[model samples]
Target chain A: MTEFLQQLLNGLSLGAIYALIALGYTMVYGVLRFINFAHSDVFMVGAFIGYYLGHHVPESTVWGGLLVLTAAMIGCALLGMLIERLVYRPLRSAPTLNVLITAIGVSLLLEYTGQLVFGAAPRTFPPIFPSANFHLGPLTISSNQLLVISVTLILLFALRFIVMRTKIGTAMRAVSLNPRAASLVGINNDFVISFTFALGSAMAAAGGILYALNYPSIDPLMGVMPGLKAFVAAILGGIGNIPGAALGGLLLGTVETFVGGSEWSTYKDAIAFAILIVILLFRPAGLLGKFTVEKV
Target chain B: MDWPLTQMLTVKNLEVCYGAISALGDVSFSIAAGRIVTLIGANGAGKTTALRTISGLLRAKSGHINFNGEDLTRLPPHQIVARGICHVPEGRMIFSNLSVDENLAMGAYLQRDKARIAQNRDYVFSIFPRLKERLTQAAGTLSGGEQQMLAIGRALMGDPKLLMLDEPSLGIAPKLISTIFEKIVEINRNHGLTILLVEQNARLALEISHEAYVLETGRVVLHGPSPELRTNPELKAAYLGG
Candidate 1:
C-alpha cells in the first residue's frame, strides 16, 4: 500500500510537469491548426533557464529563486512570442508542411543555440528548497514533489479559469472557431495567435523550472525527451483541449511510475510511445478531448 | 436619408485573391444604417470572398474598407470584430467542441458587459428557444437547423450593429428557412441592426433583402432594390429559379 501511494505522488508530480509542457503544444495547435514541432525545444529552454537562475543566484535568498523563475518564465514567453511572430507568423499563408518544417527549424535553432551558450554537457540542476521529506501514513513524499504537484495544480486551475471565463479566452476560442468570422466581428487573428504562443511558452518555462527541481539535471538537449513525452501527454489528453493536456500528463506519469517502479524502468521511454499509439488507435481525441468538425 | 445615408459600413473596389486565383475583383459596395443588404451570387461568385475580406480573413489585393468612418483595410479579424462588425460565416463556424451556451458566449468576446451578455443570451434564447433547451450540449451534436440558430445566436452575443451572414439558408429544411429569415427580419426591426447577407439562395435572399447586389464570376453584374431585382429578367434567368 505504501509503495503504491509513493508511486502515486511521484506520478502526479511528474504528470504536472508533462501537463504544463503539453499545454504549450495543445494551445499552439488549437490556434494555429498545426503541429508546433519546436514546442519541445521551448520546454528544453525552460529547464536551462531555470538551471541558470537556480545556480547563478545564491541559494540563501528566497526572493532570488522567485525572481529568477518569474524572469525565466517571462523570458521564455517572450522567446515563444518572438518565434511565432518572426517565424510562424510569416508562414501564415504557407502550407501546413512549410509551417511544420519551420517549426523543426526553430527547434534546431533553440537546441543548437543552447548548446553554443550553455555548452554541450548536461549540468546538475540545484534544488530550489531544502531536502525535506515527509511521511504520511504509509506514503513517504518529499517537499520538492509536493511543491511541484501543488504549483502544477494551481497553475492548471488558473489557466482553466482564464480560458473559460475571461474575454481573452473567448477571443482565443472565437479565432480558433472561425478566423474570418472572428475578424468580421473585428477580431485580430494575429493577436490571438501571438497570445497562444506566449501563453504556451510561459507554461513551458514554469514546467522547466519545476522539472529541474524534480529531475535534478539540466542541459540544452534536456527539453527534447520531456517535450516529446509531453506531446504524447497532450495527444493522449486531446490535442486541442486545455484540460485534456493536464489529464493526459497525469495519466502518462502514473503509467511510467508504475512501470518504472517494477523492473520496467529500462523501458520507461518506450512506455510513452506505446500508450500514445494505443490511445491514438482507440481515442484519437484523447480522454477528455472532443471532436471538432471544420466549417467547409 | 443623408447623402452618405449615415453609412455604417462601406467597401470600395475590394479585391481578394487566393494566390493566383482572384476571388473578388474590384468589388465595391456599401451598407446604410439599419438596412438588410444582400449579396446574391452563384457557387463560385465573390459573395463569401467579399465578406471574408471585410472581416479581414482574406487580405484585399486592392481597395478600401471603412467601417463607421474608420479605414479597416489594414486591420485584422478580431480587431474588426472588436469594432462591432460581427460575422456569422458560411457553413456556421460555431466552435464544435464548446458547449452550445459557451459558443454563444464566445460571440461576445470583445464586450466587457457581463450583464448585457447574459441579457443578450436570454434574448437570443427567446428568439431561438431550441438553443435554451440544448445549452449544455456540445455544439457538434446539434442538428443542421439548430447549428444555424447557434451561429446567428453566437453572432448576436457580440452585440454587433452590422451582421454579415454568408449562406444562412444553405443546407437546411425549407420550413426552418422561413423561420430563420423571419427571425432575421424581426432582429433588424426590433434591434435596428444593419445586415449584410450573402447567399446562393437567390429567391430567398431577394425576398428578404431591402436591396440586393448580384455577383457573377467575381464581379457585381447587377444591383437594385430587392423587389425590383426580383423581376429583373437577367437576374431571374441567371440566379433566381427562372
Candidate 2:
C-alpha cells in the first residue's frame, strides 16, 4: 500500500508539470485552431530564463524562488507575444497547412538557436527553493513535489478566475468560438490572440521552472520529450478544453509511473505513444471533447 | 414627401470585390436618421456585401462610406462598432458556448460604465422577456426563434445609433417571424434608432421599411419609397412573386 502511495505521489508531481505545459498547447489551439509546434521550445527557454534568474537571486529562500519563477514567466510571455506578432500574424489568412509548416520551422529555428547560444552540454539547475524530505510511514514526500502540486493548484485556480470572471478572458472565449462574430461584437481579435499566446507561454514557463526543481538537469533539448508527452496529454484530455488538459496530464503521469515501476520500465516512453495511438483510434474527439458538427 | 431629415449615412459609388470577383459594384445609397432603410434582394445580390462593407468587415475598392459626417471607409470592424453601428450578422451568430447573459455582456464590450450596462441589460430584458428567463442557459441550447431574439438583444446591449440586421427572419419559424418583426418596428418607433436592414423576404421587408433599394447582381437597379417599390411591375414580377 505504501509503495503504491509513493508511486502515486511521484506520478502526480510529474503530471502537474505536464499539465502546466499542456495548457499552453491547448490554449493556443483553442484560439487559433492550429498547433504551435514551437510551444515546447518555449518551455526550454523558460527553464533557461529561470536558470539565469536563479543566479542573481539568493537560493534556498521562498521569495527568491518565486522571484525567479515570475521573471521567467514574464520573459516567456513577452517572447510568446513577439512570436505571434512577428510570425503568425503575417500568415493570419494563409492556409492551415502553411501555418503548421511554419510552426515546425519555428521549432527547428528555436532548437538550433538554443543549441548555438546555450551550448549542447547539459548544466546543473540551481536549487531555487529549500528542499527537504518527509516520511509518512513507508511513503516519502519531497518538498519539491509539494511545491509542484501546490503551485499548479494555485495557477489553475487563477486561470479559472481569469477565464470565467474577467472581461478580457471572456473575450478570448468569444474569439475562440467565432472570430467574425467576435469582431462584430467589438472584440479586437488580434489583441485576444496575442493575449492567449502570452498567457499560454507564461504557464509553460512556470512548468519549466517546476520541472527543473524536480530533475535538476537543464539543457536546450530537454523540453522535447516532456513537451511531446504534454501534447499527448492535451489530446487525451481534449485539446482546447482547459480542465481536460490537467486531467489528461495527471492520468498519463500516473499510468507512465506505474508502468515504469514494473518490468516494462524500458518502454515507459513507448507507453505514452501507445496510449496516444489507442486514443486516436478510439476517442478521436478526446475524453471531454464534445463532437460538434460543422454548421454550414 | 420631403421632411427636413439629416442624412446619417452616405455611400457614393462604393465597390467591393472578393479577390477577382466583384461582390458589390458602384453601390450608392443614403439613410436619414431615425429611418428604417432596407436593402432587399435575392441570394448573391450584394445585399449582405453592402451591409458588411458599411460595418467595416469588408474593404471598399472605391468611394466613401460616411457615417454621421465621419469617414468609416478605413476603420476596422471594432472601431465601426465603437462608432455606434452594431451588426447582428446572418444566421444569428450568437456565441453558442457562452451563456445568454455573457453574450449580452460581450455586446457592451466598449461600454465602461457599470450602471449604464445594467440599464441596457434591463432594456434588453424588457424587449425580450424570454431572454431574461434563459439568461443562465448556453445560447446554443436555445430554440431557433429564441436564438434570433438573443442575437437582437445582444445588439441592443451595445446602445447602437445604427443597428444593421442581415436577415432577421431567416431560418426562423413563421409564427415567430411576426413577433420578431413587431419587435423590430417597436424598437425603431420607440427609440427612433437608425436601422439598415438586409433581407431576402422582399414583401415583408417592403411593408416595414420607409425607404427601399433593390439590388440585382451587384448594383442598385432601383430605389424609392417602400410603397412606390412595392407597386413597381418589374420588382413585383422579379421579387414579389408576380
Candidate 3:
C-alpha cells in the first residue's frame, strides 16, 4: 500500500505538468480548430525563459521570486502573441493544410532559435522550491511536487471559472462553436483568437516552469516530449474538451507511474496512442465533444 | 430605382464572383428603415450571394455598401455585424455543437448589458416557446422545424434594426414554413424592424414582403411595393409561379 501510495503521488505530480501543457493544445484546438503545433515550442521557450529569468533574480526577497515568475509568463505571452500575428494570422483564410504547414515552420523557427540562445546541452535548474519533502506516515512528497500539484489545481479551476462565468470566456466558446456566426454576433474574432493563444500558451509556460522545479532539468528540446505527451493526453481526454484533458492527464500519469518499468512498461507510449486511435475510430467527436454537422 | 429614399443599407454596382464565374454581377439595391423587403429569384438567381456580400462574408470586387450612412463596402464581417446589421445566412446556419441556450447567448455577442442579455434571452424564449423547451438540448439534436426556429431566434437575440434572412424555409415542413412566415410578419409588426429576406419561393416571399425585388442574373429587373409587384404581369408568370 505504501508503494502504491508513492506511485500515486509521483503520477499525480507528473500529470499536473502534462495537464497544464495539454491545456494549450486543447484550448487552441477548441477555438481555432488548428493544431497550433508551435504550441509545444512555446512550452519549450517558456522553460528557458523561466530558467533565464529565475537565474537573474536575487531570490533572497519574496518580490524577486514573484518577479521572475511574472516576467517569464509575460515573456511567453508576448512570444505566443507574436507567433499568432506572424504565423497563424496570414493562414487564417488558407486551407487547413496550409495553416498546418505554417505551424510546422513556426515550430522549427522557435526550436532552432531556442537552440541558439540556450544551446543544445541540458542544464540543471536551480531549486525554485526548498529541498524539503513532506512525509505522510510512510508516503513522502517533495515540496516542489506539492507546489506543482496545488498550482495546477488552482489554474485548472481558474480556467473553468473563466470559461463558464466570464464574458471573454463566453465569447471564446461562441467563437469556437461557430466562427462566422460568432463574427456575425459582433465578437472580434481576431481579439478572441489571439487571447486564446496567449492564455493557453502562458498556462503551458507555467506548467513548464513548475515541471523544471520538480525535475531540475532544462533544455531547448525538453518541451518536445512533454508537448507531444500533453497533446496525446489532450487527444485521450478528447481534444478540445478542457476538463477532459485534465482527467486524461491524471489518468495517463498514474497509469504510466504504476505501470512503468514493469513488463508492460514498453506499452506505455503505445497504450496512449492505441487509446486515442480506438476512441477516435468510434467517437471521433471526442469524449465530451458533441458532433457537428455542416449546413449548406 | 434611384433609391432616393434615405437608404439604411445601400449596395451600388455590386459585383461578386466565385473564382472565374460571376455568381452575381452589377447588383444594386437599397433598404430603408422600418421596411420589409425581399429578393425573390430562381434557384441560381444569386439571391443568397447578394446577401452574403452585403454581410461582408464574400468580398465585392466592385461596389460600395453604405449601412446606416456608413461605408461598409470594405469593412470586415464582424465589423459589419457590430454596426448593427444581423445576418441569418442560408439554410438555417445554427451552431449545431452548442446548446440552444448557449446558441441564444451568442447572438448577443456585441451587447454589453448583462441585464439586457437576460431580458433578450427571455424575449427569444417567449418568441419561440419550443426553443425554451429545448434550452439545454444540443442544437443539432433539435428537429428540423425547431432548428429553423432556433436559427431565427439566435439572430433575433442580437436585437438588430436590420435583420437579413436567407431561405429560412428551405428544409422546413410546409406547415412550419407558413408558421415561420407568420412569425416573421408578427416579429416585424411587434418589433418594427427592417428586414431583407432572400428566397426561392417567389409566391411566399412576395406575399409577405412589404416591397419586393425580382432578381435575375443578379440584377433587380422589377421592383415596387408588394401590392403592385405582386400583380405585375412579367413577375407573376416568370417568378411568382403563375
Best by TM-score: 2
Task: Please write out the lDDT profile of model 2 over residues B210-240, one tens digit for every residue.
Answer: 9999999999999999999999999999999
The docking category that best describes candidate 1 is medium
Higher-ranked by TM-score: 2 or 3: 2
Instruction: Look at candidate 3 and give me any clashing residue pairs.
Output: none
Candidate numbers, best DockQ first, in rank order: 2, 3, 1
Clashing pairs in 2: none
Q: Regarding lDDT, does 1 or 2 come out ahead?
A: 2
Question: Which digits, one per residue and each the tens of the lDDT, describe model 1 over residues A95-158?
Answer: 9999999888889998999899999987888765556789887788887787788778888888
| lDDT, model 3, position B34 | 82
**Model 2, A150-268: lDDT tens per residue?**
99999999998898899999999998899989999899999999999999999999999999989989889999988998999999989999999998889888888988998899998
Better of 1 and 2 by DockQ: 2
* DockQ of prediction 3: 0.62
Reference interface contacts recovered per candidate: 0.65, 0.75, 0.67
Candidate 1 residue lDDT tens string, B139-183? 979988899999999999988878999899888888999999999
**Most accurate candidate by lDDT:** 2
Model 2 segments beyond 4 Å from truth? B1-5
Candidate 1 wrong stretches, greater than 4 Å: A55-67, A290-295, B1-8, B113-126
